[model samples]
Target: MKSGCQWRMMPKDFPPWQTVYDHFSRWNKAGVWECALDKLNERYRHSKKRAVPSYAIIDSQSVKTVYASEERGIDGGKKIKGRKRHIIVDTVGNLLHVSVHRANINDTKTGVAVFERAAEKYPSIKAFSGDAGYRGTAVTFVEERLKLKLNISTKIKDVFAVLPIRWLVERTFAWLNGFRRLAKYVEILTATAENMIRIAMVRLTLAKLP
Candidate 1:
């Protein structure tokens, strides 16, 4: 296939393109990716000797797509193109939740789902940090449903204070980009794209294991 041809030209040794493609496709079909994320989250919770995250930082990023058919028209606002990636990261920068949707979905709308899911999984989250996009209902839900305080950065000064802590999640995303499959939006199905993200996270965690 086309992917195999691209792999052949690369300098490093890799599994046959067909094998990589098939593994990813099968895992996505079986919902194995989500299950893997849950497992990793549980591992982090149980293995940590100190304490669970008290504050979490949430954000979304836009990943551009080359194929028009792959693009979903979710009013990306000023950045009106590609898909949206919603991620919730712990204060220390470990990923807690991740979701992918069409480009136009409001960040607030998705924030609730991410918070709900994270609370159900971790149950120890006490606070969350996000950008202004998460101000409205999302903030309300975190305080009411999850009983966690919300800290959303708005002004330049607040941004400066939170940027250092927030960079952990961004760094993780950068690590994900090392995988060629994530370098570009190649998966036609949304589920497959999510599976790729989960796989990258699992691989990253395993690499860090002592």
Candidate 2:
């Protein structure tokens, strides 16, 4: 994953490519990657002397998708034809939850599902920070449906200053770029794409543990 090499192109020093891919596919289907991420996130948070996070930063990224039969579409705002991923991260940048869908889907609609899943898993999260992209129905959905607050960070134009609370999730996406495989959506299914991201975070969180 770090090298982003194709499955069959994996170095022979490792196990057979099929063997490695099988284990990865099985784990993805079983939710092992997410479970490990949760356990390791808790451990890392405890090491930092933090409590279960009460707030998180939410953001979405639109990436170009491979020309395939995958469920991909154009993000009119970004003018990119691909899939969009919504990722939620804690204040310290640990990944909380992620979801992938067609780029044409509205952020508010996707944000609801992402927030719901994360809230169910981490009930302590009572609020979230996001940019103006989630303005209209997003804030309302969070308050009414999820019983959570969505704080839209003020957008400062003509300048590159970082928005403290919101940039953390953007940095997480930057970290993802380090993995070449993530440069584009290559998986045949969005569910697999989502798990592929979880797998990337699992590697990152594991490194921080020891």
Q: Point to the candidate with the largest TM-score.
A: 2
Write candidate 1's Cα lDDT for 14-33 as tens digits: 67767876776787888787
Tens digit of per-residue lDDT, candidate 2, span 1-210: 677788889997999999998998898889998888888899999988886999999999999888883779999999999999999999867899999999999998778878888889899998998888888788888899898899999858768888877878888999898887788888888888988898888888877775
Root-mean-square deviation of every model? 3.9, 1.3
Q: TM-score of the candidate numbered 2?
A: 0.95
- Candidate 2 global lDDT: 0.87
Distance from true location, Cα of 55 in model 1, Å: 3.0
TM-score, prediction 1:
0.77
Q: Residue 130 lDDT in model 1?
A: 81
